[model samples]
Target: MGKTTVIHHAPLVGYPDDKLYTVRVIDGVIDGIEEEVEGKYINGYDKASVEEIDLAGKEWLSPSMIDWHVHTKLAALHSNRLNLSNCQSASEVFESVKQALNDPKYDTSLERNLVGINMRNSNWTDEDLFSLEKMNELSIERPIFLLYNGYHSMWCNSLALEVGGYGSSLNHKGHLVEQEAFDMFPKLTTANNQVVDNWILQESKKAAAMGVTEIVDLEMEHNIVQWQRRYAAGNDYLRIHVGMYTPHIQDAIDLGLTSGDDVPHTDGLIKIGPYKIVTDGSLGSQTAFCHDAYPGTKDNHGIYYYPPESLSEMIETGLKHNFKFAVHAIGDYANHLTLQTISKASSKPRIGSTIEHAQLLDIEKDLPIFKDLGLIASIQPSHLVDDRDLCHKFWPGREHRAYAFKSIVDAGIPIKLGSDAPIAPMNPWEAMAVCITRAGQGDEKNPFIEAEILDLETAWKASTSNGKTRLEVGDRADLCILQSDPLKLDAAGLRAMKVNGTMLGGRWTHKTF
Candidate 1:
């Protein structure tokens, strides 16, 4: 292998192939990977006056992680908003609001439109509206929105409802479910390009620091334009795979865009990806399209957003234009219809469609269909732990059917793990830990559906790509150096991994080396 830059004597990790290698790179592409042989090494470059990174034979080199599902722009939006992620109770949520409003940094301008995220009040009874009473207590003069932990529902103040052109009587107090909330997201999250771009840039860098080098952004807006602008502004730390929202597929088609089209005004930082179609609601909102109704309600079978026939047509149309589907289906019935739609589509998506959040499954029946359709399960392991209580309260007796990660893998359907960004966190380490444990790091819920727990090796392989991890000849030189080998450590060690540095195409992105 001949190269201009050489990483000498590094203990290569990840990928099933090689263990120790001196990797050679030429202009960000791997030229050759020479395995350590005969207790010696090989240098593909001039020894003297040539720059090289010596690993000292102690550091562990791993392939950079790829998050298969994320909403890059919205992640930034959520991060910039008033964060309420760890507020376990309703009072804490209100306290957080009071604290944020009192802070001098907090802007009270009506135009600012305060919004909070990651709120979970699972202790509330089913009869509870998860009302906006607390929100209105602060002040109804300026609009405020509080998004539920699952993005399926949100509670807003009276002013927010009024401004959004919805009457207070339209929903429970000021809460909007499913379709209404999703529709409100684009309108409520208005901000100048600079603000959004800055936040996105900040979040992307943070991901690099956490060992992620690539993300498939399933943003609700026109992500192509957003990424183009961001990348043109000289922000190219993360390799973004941009997805157009389901409603905007026509816009992409009108602009003559295809699935693999490179984003304009960027140095290969962005590429077109799937068409995101959310077919069902979430368990948290009690709107997942399940075969049985929610625990308390008799006729509440949950809403299937679109008819299967129409949904299949959309899939076929996307495939006609060479776009895969990242279908969001959380319930058993939703997963059922999604599979049937993919199987019945006139043309197959080039890379095949994936069922996003394939959360719940009717194991005996769905397992075969998963294998038969050869679908890709784009799942998040963190959801299992998060949804544990929701499953108990809303989906009693069927808890085993939810977040069935191990079963999906055993059924031979390919799986890719991700944080789902704002919905979960974008840390792959956390995702791997939760997948293996079926509970969060240090969580005491006793591993919901413990039989579904995956081993560390299984979880890691599912979460990362062989292409990124393996030191194959002529592969992209994207690597991450860790202070310790992940495989050698326990679950906690993996989640608390010390990222020494990150490299993209043989160049350092986050370096402490």
Candidate 2:
């Protein structure tokens, strides 16, 4: 921690355009702020201050984005976990795997299996996890797992199944969907605590570069222990709220956990978060537990991982342990069921909950329920760009309902935005652009659900914390100093805007200054 540090003559974001202000901070907390005088700025703090970074040339300063959902480890777990994000065909996926096979870390032995991630196959002609079948192309000889882009499904070879202790439980071989993937992913990958902790820090630095100061990591394994260790090892770069997977709820209760308890001491950098429960599937996998059968599949109503009674019981039990929820729902039917279960079990409990995704919402039918219950809407706007084609293909004739951002906002619900990183880019600017433009990165001509587009102010408020005092005289100095005005920039400019610095509690986590 340092003495009073001043940011001089920077345009304060989310405010009137004509004024520039000098801001001061001390010991990781905001001290005071004063507007510029006669086209000049003066340091607000004492002249005896230890240091000052002149920001007279800086373009803008605003609160750094808070990512509501991210997978800390999956962002970049290993050097060999192939990145196939934009791949369009099955052949591209196989090529990436083959290319990654060149890494000396992986060998031909089935015991030392290979894994790849972010391959999308829904729009491909083959629509299979891999191009070849029956472990052909030598795919069967060595185990390999190609995770889908949305992480709703996982495709693995026969050797992967046998080597990972899952072959005996199944009669057939195919992509593991929803709960199977949820339960089996950690098993398939070799768990290395140190490797994962280091990976989490490296990924956090990438997020810091994007002007993000806080993130909630809802990765499906036991996250508390890993985060605790990281903080103990002095890896605190940005604030992290580690979430508990529902299967580990009892473990959390056994440990006497509360939402904001620190692990030894993280200097307020680490906190406990809500319990994450995946109650539904995703549209890309054609298993979102929809109200009607998808146009292409027969008798495919989709899958509900939780029965109502069981889900309600889980919520009630979690409430007993002072835990809130972040329930996953992608389909209309799933949302309806989630609301029903929450409504039935939510009373007499004091913790708040958010329905994650809420992608395919029946606004007219569900908005009232959400309003009456007073729940938070944790949405990922960037998913719209990636899901436009799939939404139309799988959830046909529901263009208006899919990715319904405007409807949810208009209903006056509290909105929290995130990237669902690794699933999406974790870039706040790109997320904000897609939120306001209905356009994907580098593809402005194609807009999905044009009416759902938001204004820059609203998008910024949703993407970043607007602050209780709006960065007044005294506030926590979490900020992102940029080189351009977000409101003045177009989608491309916004996406490409330069981040001069990012501050987590008045300390420069990532800074060019």
Candidate 3:
């Protein structure tokens, strides 16, 4: 591939003390950065051997965003089977599934077909997974599998259930099951290991268009192979950090994979992230483990998913293998327990000990503990707007710390943002809008959580290229040249921000749409 060169002229953000400066690029790294310069082209390589292109002063050159948690192909993987997140009523979900049977959008007869669908709590029932009548109704002339909002749950139609050997199994309510069902879920889904790999590469390009230079891919046990294959394919458009789910921690350790182990691209491109564990369910389902019961509930603290002692043992096992923990703690109690577990499991402070969704926090106390404990809140701000209704209803008296971004920042914990795509869309700008507006446009009935509101810079910092820190001298030249400066744009304007061009590793990966 030929190296494309460019001279950029936008004021750079994220310099020490949040200063702006000018930068020049050679191949894929920042060759020079200066403040108050009288114009200098510092070309190091033989000028005769390099090709150059000028920016024409139309683009705001900035490092791309880095979404720490997102599911790519898997985000839309089951659209053909069922979709829970899209429908407000059970009939809507059924109609959506019914439409997939005859929708010309997909060539349903193709072998190795993958369909993405969404389902909601209202649409699911105990026997839905084994419903032959429903499968017949939504038949797309091929195997079909439906994925739920949490991404952990899967509901297979009769054809999929039969092929995956789960047609007769009955152990759990709705579509959720234990290891057996979880294992079967992936097989029944449209995106097989290989298909998923291809889709992620395509999705990664979309992310690159959004100026996402880096991503922390938290792969499920079955996705490790897909990750390896995609990385080996040599499309280094985005620097990726791979993570192993907790169920695969032992296998990863056996295979000599630990936190920070490099596999492809640069040393940090494909490293293992925290050992991921889901401590509780989500707020939408009213299953987030909380200290206080949900509003309508009389006497339940939700489910703990994993017992404290078991979680501790798991932490100890992970620690022995030099793995950092990425606990998915959505509720206040779940968050508190995960924090306590970390305190007891490890003596010395460990970096990258992230609490996913730290959504419902006790900010005044929890924020400081996270700061002192060195924990990162791997948050998905979009969840706030999507789940606002349930949040208000379920979180009666404890609405204070819900989605408390500003307080969390003030308390001193580094905040990393993500799309959590299958639950929300994979648009950082959408999240940015939520982070700032805290309201879902024109929804007067829904108000922004007062304490959670963040300033533009903080919101920008949490989602932009600086969000992941990739603007050093020798960093990958993955960046987006925007028509408008995000820093200068309003919250709603952030979503409409034009993509002038995208450069991944110094190559023009995508041009303006």
Candidate 1 collision pairs: none
* lDDT per model vs. reference: 0.78, 0.77, 0.67
The digit string of per-residue lDDT tens for model 3 on 1-513 reads: 245364534545444433345565666676666653455444345556555544545556677777878655455353333344667655566667666556665555433443444455532344233444565556635666655566545555556666666445652222444344457645654445566666667777777777777777665554455566777775566766667786666666777877778754443456666777888877765678888987657887777777778988887887788777778889898888878777776553358778889988776656766777788888898888766766767787677778888888888888878988766767788778777777775652455676567887777777765554336666667777777667777766887877767776677778753
TM-score of each predicted structure versus truth: 0.93, 0.92, 0.85
Candidate 2: tens digits of C-alpha lDDT, residues 297-361: 78897898888999998888877777767888989999999998888885733435778999998
Highest lDDT, which number?
1
RMSD of each: 2.7, 2.7, 4.1
The global Cα lDDT (0 to 1) of model 3 is 0.67
Error of 2 at 32 (Å): 1.0
Q: What's model 1's lDDT at 205?
A: 88
